[model samples]
Target: MTDTDVVVIGAGLAGSTTAAILGRAGIPTALVDPHPVYPPDLRCEKLDRGQVAILQKTGLADIALAATTFDGAIRDGKAWIARFGRVIDKRPGGQYGILYDNLVNVMRSAIPPDVTNVVAKAVHIVTGDDRQQVSLSDGSTISTRLVVLANGLSVALKDQLGIERTVTSPCHSITIAFDIKPRSGRAFDFAALTYYPERASDRMAYLTLFPIGASMRANLMVYRTMDDPWLREMRHNPERALFALMPNLRRIIGDVELVGPVKIRPADLYVSQGHRQAGIALVGDAFASSCPAAGTGAGKVFTDVERLCNVHIPNWLASPGMAVNKIEQFYDDPVKREYDETSKSWAYRLRSMSIEEGISWRIQRRLRFFVGAAISAACKIGVISDGDQFVPEGWTQRLRDRT
Candidate 1:
């Protein structure tokens, strides 16, 4: 039997990062995961400036920088945004491109020497008001004061704890990723590019191309069902399907060749119910899920980790028992709630803007592009110093308010 202050299940991005922060603060934490080294998976591969700042707040910025394969800061912090086969705007870019597994491995490595690494599966968790017991597949038991569930999309443990995840939207969106390079073996014209969809019927939200090491990575998010024929065609002939959806893309980026396997992930938006229990806390996807198109996964995860680790945990530890009321405070955190709600709102908004063919939606979509083009023109003519000024006052503003 082993004992610790906190037992973190699932050593992926959320779990590993949580353990890293807690361990750095001198908390006795035990991180449990089946694999010593996380395997490659299709997840958020790009860390935008907002996410970097959030990680910086948690003091994990250096760890993230070290794992990144491509640093946009080195390229003068510029990425082109295009629509209708032409560049529409340029945004400040400190985005980092990295493989999901690579980032997880680096995070796992950063776990302090004193933090115990339990390389085994957490089969069951027994939560109590004063103590918690986590059962590992290796027939080991870990007793702790609290359990941080960061397993992400795994429901067995949650089910055992009687926590239920309500799927708000089924098959909310699909993410397609692949490597691309010009057929002429030459480099792309820009450091990074985000090309918006040409038509609503195409169901594409956007195609983002960014550097990862020596290769240019492409991530396409679409509002499509799982059994859609387009998905089948995409898996069979990704290049053809991609170009068919965005015919003008070839003219803008020049002819390109697809390399490596095309990775696809279908996301479902969900939120956990009955989670405000004693001796347990859920973070990241374990608590809820967001659409990949929203690009808010990392931000949500970072916010949860920051709030739980820096604020709630310290306060919780200072008290006697891990009661339900004490655990509820973390869930009720304003900052954390804002990020979670923003992710949900963005998911619905982006999907509607991309695929909804109603008259109002069509008009709104066109108006959105018109506004973007106008903003681009204004920035070019020095009418506005920053294009971000024209951005709306809702979720975007909330994201910028990191304080």
Candidate 2:
């Protein structure tokens, strides 16, 4: 049996970052993962400016930025991508575009050399008053003061620990990812672009196009059932189905050909309850899964690692045994609570914005794109100065009231 101060399961972004931070602080931390090399996974393709800031706070900003780089875009007028790029370039910490697997590997590789890397699955976790015991597939055990669960959506570990998730929406949204290249074999004019859905029948929230490496990646997000005929059509004939769903994509990205298979993921919104247990804590998707459309997964996960590693854990270890009260502090953290609540609200908003057939939503949807285009036009003509506060106060809520 080996012993450590903390055992971080699931060597993903959240887990690896936590272990790295603790190890840097000279804490005895063990990171366990089934695979020595993280398998290719398709999740968040790009990180917005806000998420970059959060990673900066965790001291992993350089690691993340180096993993991948791409230009940022917003759905404004035709020139919006240019304007957005200028702003991003001027910002302290700009956005990033990296594949999910590359991002996770970069974080894992950055873990301090002192941290123990266990290449085995954590079969079971048993928590107690003074210590927690984690049984691995190799028939070895690790006794630690705290356990950080960052295994993402897999609930087997949580189930053994008697934790249940409160699913707000099952199959809340659908995401399809694939690679595309210009038909003429020429590079795209822009580094990235966001194309919004123009028709209700498309049932799409938006289509994001960005460069991952040598090839351009396309991620189309929509609010529809997996059984929907369109999904099947997309899987069978992605080239035609995708362009049909979002005709504006061709105009924005130019003529392109599919270079890979269509990858589909049905996102579900869930928050783990009954996780404030002694000797253990949950973070990332294990604690609460976010809507991919909302783009809050990285933010929430980074915040958890930041709070736990920088603030809560140090204070807890300075004293005695890991108690329920000590672990509860992480759950009740104001920043963490805010991130959780905001993620839920964004999930509801993104879904409602896409599929709600009500009159109010109809008007809001139209205005959202219209206002964005108008702002972009204004910026181009110098009607609205850069760095100025726009958007008339009370105008947004008044529109919601149908005033």
Candidate 3:
């Protein structure tokens, strides 16, 4: 481990993207994670407009966009997607929906080699009056001026920082996706998130069908059921539950199809009340996230990286010493804005479970609707200054009394 300008703790999209951008910007970066390859993460199926723009700006866009391509209904030309819960039907060149790992590979290749990419977990985050150091599980230390906690929701690391983040309800979520050939007269176009439009359980499950890769595929998400913990036994038992909820899925695949078993995990979305802490900044899911789990974490990570590169970097560079005040200001400003953008869509989806059950939660629903529509319109029209901070126009005010 060496002293670096930045040590990104997680080699996922956010980590890699930050490293790629920072390294290219001449800022030395180190990326840490546990051997980045994982089975394809299915639920997070989108690459957003802002992220698309960021990638394009960074010059890595074409590689990622071309590595994966889709055929079927094109929103603007790709697939229709949702952000903060409102379905975006106007994506130019459509929306991209390839497997999660596929995108990771595309991003990984873009990072400069000078930016060391290590496969290790960050075990301790030590903050001092000066530079910060991160202890790794591998018995190594990597020091940095700042650390970006882009790792998606890891309670362990958060605890290590003495950061007490709320679970905000025991709400958990998981998504499983696989490909299948179409039966005669039956095919699903790669447009719209179709399948489960309503909540089906305390699991609050929903199934979606999309044309992905070489065949027709389906993605299912079961939101926080008491019994199914993703890190536990769900992967092995996917088939058992698959047959129960979707008979068509069972029939379409039959025995010949290669079932890429279900992958489950808690799906609840959360954001820091403020920057998770100082000396460290939490970007993406470690700080802010969106749902129906719209793939906002990736977008947010890029936003964090862009802001760091464009805004934060200039300010930090001009300082003669540790810019504690600047860092703190940077952290606080985003926490407010990130949560504002992330909470509305996800909170609405969480509340959707209440609605389908006829809970008479009218006022909240109306506000959620207004906020969603207004935000969608604002984002579409480019009225919002930062695509990253689209707060669904008056979202907080409308739902002010409810939560």
Candidate 4:
């Protein structure tokens, strides 16, 4: 058996980052994953300013810089934020566009030399008060003081350990991703653009256009079921369906052509139940899933890593054993709880704002956009200093307090 202080299973964003931080702190850590090179996958392809700040705070900002194809900070570019076909604000740089696979690979590469990389699938895990054991498919066993489960939404390992997940909302949201280019053969007027849905009846939250390398990538977030005919139309004829859904988009970006296959990802909101166990901790999607439309997925992951590595794990390691009560402290952490709750709340709020058709919902939707437009105008005319005022009401303040 290999001995280590920490064994992080599933070396994706959360696992690799945890190992990196712990390794830097001179801890005996082992990272377990089957893939030496993370394969191409569809996930959050962009990182916002708030997520970047968290990565920097955790000393993982360099990994993001290395993986990103379009570095807004270095490019010194601005993005146009618009709603109802009207430009709301020209936001400054600090965001980045990156492929999910590249980001994971970069994060895996940054693990310090001392951290052991176990290139095999974890078949089973046994958690105890003093020691946890992990069984790999390659017939190896690793005994460690604690295990951090960052394997995303995979349920096999979680099931072996008796962790249950409860589905909050099934088929919560759908995200459509593809590449686009101007048919006119001319460059777009802006570096990036975010176009909000013109009407809640459209069932779409927004369509974001940003650069990933030379390609202009579009992520259209909608509140729809998997079997919806509209999704079929998008799959069969993405360009026509997209233009039909948002005709005003042509007026802003001019004529555009879809360059590649349209990829659709349907997400369900769930939270892992019975996770407060001995010798184990959950992070990122392993604990709960977030709505892509809310743009809170990366933020939640970064927060989980930051809190676990810097605060919880350090204190846990200084003690004698990884007991159930000690592990519970991280789960009951005020900061982690707040961030998780905020993400869940925002997901439901965005769903209602996009698809709810009641009179009150319509009125509130209009008012929300009106307030956003007002804030944008206020920032333009020197009445307000912070451009983030245009964010959903109370979101900026809550993030400020937490981060």
Candidate 5:
């Protein structure tokens, strides 16, 4: 039997990040996972600028950025836009493209030397007001003050503890991933490209093209069933199915070829029920599952790790034993709740905006793009105050004065 102040189950990004933070803070922590070298798993491959900012706040951004190669621009079929510069200019980071397993390894590598790393499955967990005991499959036991569940959507652990999942949508969205290659046997024109669904029948949300190391990767997001024929075709013959669905991308990609097998992921939205218990807490996908189309999966998990490690855990530890009241404070946290809600909302929006045939959504779709275009035009023409004004900032002003 081994004992520690905190024991975190699952050493993926969420658990590893939590362990790293708590370990660095000089807290006795233990992180356990089934795989010492995590195998390949499909999830969010790239981190947007917004997600990057949250990671930056957690002090792990530099470590993650150091492991990847990024040049800071993405082309969305039309033209190349400086994604990091336009949205998060105040911060100096860009969209980062990294493999999911690589990311988890990088975070796990940052786990403090003092924190214990247990390589076994957490079979059962028993929680109490003062202490929690976790039983590993290897016949070892861990007794700790608190247990952090960062495991993704695994009900066996939660079910044993009498926790239920209130599912919002059982089969919310479908994601397909494949490698990108040029038919001419050369490099692509752009570093990255994001192509939106062309018509209503396509049933696609968007297709993101980005680089992961030397290989270009394409992730196609759609709102469809797992058994849909199109999905079958994608699995059997990915190249043809992909081109048939998003034909407009042919021009941008020139001649395209797919390198490996097409991977399919069915995303389900759900929030854990009865998880705010004494001496135990949940984080990352264990707390809630978000739609991949919404691109809120990583952001929500980062928020969970950030809030739990930095704010709530410190306050919880300063007191006596881990109680239900201390655990509830984290579940009721304003920022964490907001991010979870935003993910749910965006999941609905992405599905409706792609497949909804009603007049309301139709009008909304047009207006959304129109508003974005109007804002871009306003920024370009230097309309500072009113509609018909050309007031550029800094260098443009100096050029106007010279004229």
Candidate 6:
């Protein structure tokens, strides 16, 4: 087996990201995955406002993203002015519907060629007392000083490491997506997240649409629980349920458009955690992944690259013999702290769950409406503070400045 300093399995966000950072830091590294594409396929049709902040902070703001044009929103039956608050993005109004593949292309272009992207299908990972080895299905093998697993889903290596992959939520949902070309000088709005969150379909199904290109192209996301009767109709007759959500969408899209027969993905959350054996590190979803409400996967992985590069790798370089313990300590301490905070934040804001389940869900859901109304009221009442007038650090002044 060939020996290397580090071997990363799976070329999803986490793996590709870390490989890029490490290679830039002058570490000999190899990234392996069967797929040639850098951005792996993603079922998620949208990224929330927070995700945009993380993406821009990571120095990828120059790339293009899909967007819509609306300015205000009706949240829980009340009006609210939408504003973009991400620190890196100066785009004032809202977030973007970045195509998954396009985002990958941007990130890939940023990574250097020295960090080899070996095309191979990884089947298993062996963690030894001193190091690790990734066995591939192609009968090739390589040993490394450390192995970082960034595979996107529940992994067989989790079982080998004695980790449990469990699902907590009972009501599972799936997403169906397709694309349509737009018309004229118009493009989907980039200043707001347009959605009919409370709109209903036959037996209560709903579809979410997002803009994904320069002129006019859209990606639609439809969600339904396993037992939801609307799912059957969607699979059998897709068009009827689609036009109901956006009326002008059909006329603009025409009799047919390019791309997609519609794809479906389970909307359930998966949690996996355990002791990281000495020679291994679990990055990204290999450790835990949440439902749509806690849209932290991409941001979390970006944080992983930042941490491993800035914190973890430097320590290991200072003391090569003490590598395993350094990585494991990161998992137990700072990583877990971040997870706990993020998860608690998700738990508190799940609006659709039972009262006993989400501690502050309803209030959280209604917050957008309240904030929107307050902003409108302030604008109407001529009480706009230019950062100096409102107690020096008031939220309203800060939001206006951020926007």
Measured by lDDT, the strongest candidate is 1
Error of 5 at 245 (Å): 0.9
Model 6, stretches more than 4 Å misplaced? 38-40, 45-49, 56-91, 170-172, 180-193, 199-208, 215-223, 243-259, 322-324, 333-336, 351-367, 375-403
For 236-326, candidate 3 gives per-residue lDDT tens digits of: 6655555555444433234323255544445565556545444677766777555543344555566666666556755675655444575
Local lDDT at 370 for model 5: 53
**Local error of candidate 5 at residue 63 (angstroms):** 0.3
Residue 214 alpha-carbon offset, candidate 5, angstroms:
1.4
The 10-residue segment of model 4 with minimum total lDDT is 394-403
- How do the residues 1-403 of candidate 1 rate in per-residue lDDT, one tens digit apiece? 8989999999999999999999999999999999988999999998876777788878888978787855455365568878888886675555689988888888888889999998899998898899999999999999999999999999999999899999999989999999999999877878888898988888889999888888889999998898899899999998889888888888789888889999999999999998989999999999999888888998899999999999999999987999999999999999999989888988898888888889998888777756665654665677764534565433332332210
lDDT, candidate 1, at 379: 58
Candidates arranged by lDDT, highest first: 1, 4, 5, 2, 3, 6
Report every candidate's CA lDDT. 0.86, 0.78, 0.59, 0.85, 0.80, 0.54
lDDT per residue, candidate 6, 241-278, as tens digits? 55544544443233533445555565556666664566
Candidate 3, residue 320: CA error in Å? 2.7
RMSD values for the candidates in order, in angstroms, are 3.1, 5.1, 7.0, 3.1, 6.7, 6.9
Clashing pairs in 5: none
Backbone clashes in candidate 6 total 7
Q: What TM-score goes with each of the models? A: 0.93, 0.89, 0.71, 0.93, 0.89, 0.73
By TM-score, the better pick of 1 and 3 is 1
* Better model by lDDT: candidate 3 vs candidate 4: 4
lDDT of 2 by residue, 1-403 (tens): 9999999999888898898889889999999999898898878887865677678888888877877864543222111221211211111112367888889888888899999999999999999879999999999999999999999988889999899988889998888899988899887765665666665666777776676767778788899887899899998988889777765556656678888788999998888878889999899998888888777888888999999999999999999999999999999999999888988887888777777789998898767655655654565577864333464432332222121
- Of the candidates numbered 3 and 6, which has the greater lDDT value? 3
Lowest summed lDDT over 10 consecutive residues: which window, candidate 3?
394-403
TM-score, predicted candidate 4 vs. hidden true structure:
0.93
